[model samples]
Every structure is written in structure tokens, then in C-alpha cells.
Target: MPKITDQVSDSGIYLLEIVVPDDFYTEIKKYEGRKFPKGFYYYAGSAQKNMRKRLERHLKKNKNIYWHIDYLTSRFNIGKIFYFNNCGKEFECDLVADLIEKFGLIPAAPGFGNSDCNRCDSHLLYSEAPLDYSHFISRYQSIARFIPSSNDTF
Candidate 1:
């Protein structure tokens, strides 16, 4: 597993592996003209100034719903978080495209968490199973390498 050794640069991209258990009832009926089932939801997001704060807000249970991902995070629990420390802005969309093109992962909903990016159909990807973290750590190479953080449940 990857570890967090630096705290200076909080700017980077993150992928949230949110798991809605098989028995869990998903509250979102429809979003952006699409429907999603109970499964693993991967949301790609970036925090240029404060990644820690952005992540904390996402994991918080009682926060207000602002982003598209909040609709789900407010209802379900996040299973894992993977991040690229000190990374640039472009990687947010690149990461989403990687999952769709290389891993064959499909978008959970169109335009979900991708209002600012034109390169992706959505920043959220869905799978019927768990995601393999090794894929990012092993095969991918960016200016700032992707690492699995020690953060768990905020």
C-alpha cells in the first residue's frame, strides 16, 4: 500500500472508491439523465489548495450537498481513497479517462462531477466489483505519482 510522507503540497487529484453494499439502498433515483445501481463508485476529484480539507468534507456524514459526488457520499460510505500528491489539474480528467479506456470502467452518470472538464463524460466511474489499487501504482506514471493514502473514514 502507498503511504503519505509529504504534507507541503496539498494540491492533487484523488479517486474515491465508494462502496454501496449489496443490501444498501441507494437514495439517488436519477442524476444527469442516468440511473446507477448499487456497486463500487469511483469519483475523481481535485483539490488545488487543500486536498486534506476537500477529502475530509467528502467523508463527513453531516455536510451539505454541493458536488455531484455529495449526493452519493451523503448516503453511502467510502471504501477507499487514492491520491496523487502535488499533482496538476489535468490529471483529474486523465484519471477518469484512464479508468474508462484502460480498465473498461463505465461512467455512473453523465456529467457527474465533470462540470469543469470537457474531456470526460463524468468524473464518476462505476463497477460491479472492487477496484484494484495496484493498477494506478504499478502501471501509471505521472508528474506526481499516485499513492494510496493512510486516511480511512476521515
Candidate 2:
């Protein structure tokens, strides 16, 4: 298990681990119908204000689906949340790009979670295996933080 730090930031970047159990197709608002296979997914996002509240909303079972991530998290369970304190929004794109370049992780959906981002193909990445957070932390030692779902609280 990874340790949770006591330090908290009002705004920062976060990665959500989502698990889908079977193959299924569903339409997401304006995007094309998406096909989700049984596997794990990682979504990177940023909240520039009230970061803890944003994360808490994601963990809630009942809420209005507002963002692309909301659509997914509303359907599937989020197993973990890895975050970085005081990280700017740009770091969200950087993390996604790094995952693509270094880990060869591809987007599960082309425009998922990046309607506003011009630099990233998508903020959501799919994988057969869980991401190695230790490796990411080793590379970004100064900012990386980990919080498993069991320990996450507002």
C-alpha cells in the first residue's frame, strides 16, 4: 500500500484509476459511441480551486454528470486517486503526454476529458495492467502524491 501525505493543496492535478468489467458501448453526450473493454483506465485532471471538493464529488455515488469524467465515474468504480500538490493545469497535459510517450499508453477515447485542452489528444488512457505509480513518482519526485480509494476523504 502507498502512504497518504498529510499535506493538502487547494488546487492541483489528479489521476483516477477506473475499472470496467466487460465490453460495452455507450454514447457520451457529444462524443461518438465508446467501446469499453474489461480492463483498467487512468484519467488525469486538474482542479484550480477547491481541489478536495472536486475529488470528493468524483467519489460520490450520486451527482449530476457534468464533465466527461463524470459520465465514466458515474458508471464505474474509481479504485484509486494519485495526485500532486500545487500542480498547475499544464501539468495535467504533461502527465498524459508522459504516459503516452514513456509507457505507450493510448487514449481509450480520442476526445475524452480534453474538450478544453488543445495540447492533449485525450486525458484518459487505457491499459491491461495497472499503472506503475512508483515509476511516475520516481520521475516526478518533487510533486507526486498517492492516495488509494480506501483512504481518500474530503
TM-score of every model versus the real structure: 0.80, 0.87
Q: 70-121, model 2: which lDDT tens digit per residue? A: 8778788888878888889999999999998998788888888998899988
Q: Relative to the true structure, how large is the alpha-carbon lDDT of every model? A: 0.74, 0.81
Q: Evaluate model 1: give its lDDT.
A: 0.74
Model 2: lowest-lDDT 10 consecutive positions:
1-10
What is candidate 2's TM-score against the reference?
Answer: 0.87
Best lDDT among the predictions, by candidate number: 2
Separate clash counts for every candidate: 0, 0
Model 2, C-alpha of 97: deviation from truth (Å): 0.4
Candidate 1 Cα deviation (angstroms), residue 61: 0.7
| lDDT (10s digit) by residue, model 1, range 1-154 | 2244455257888888887875344345554334468788899999999887887788787888777788788878777777788778898888888898888789977777888988888898988987666665576654434434355332
Off by over 4 Å in 2: 1-6, 151-154
Q: What lDDT score goes with residue 136 in model 2?
A: 74
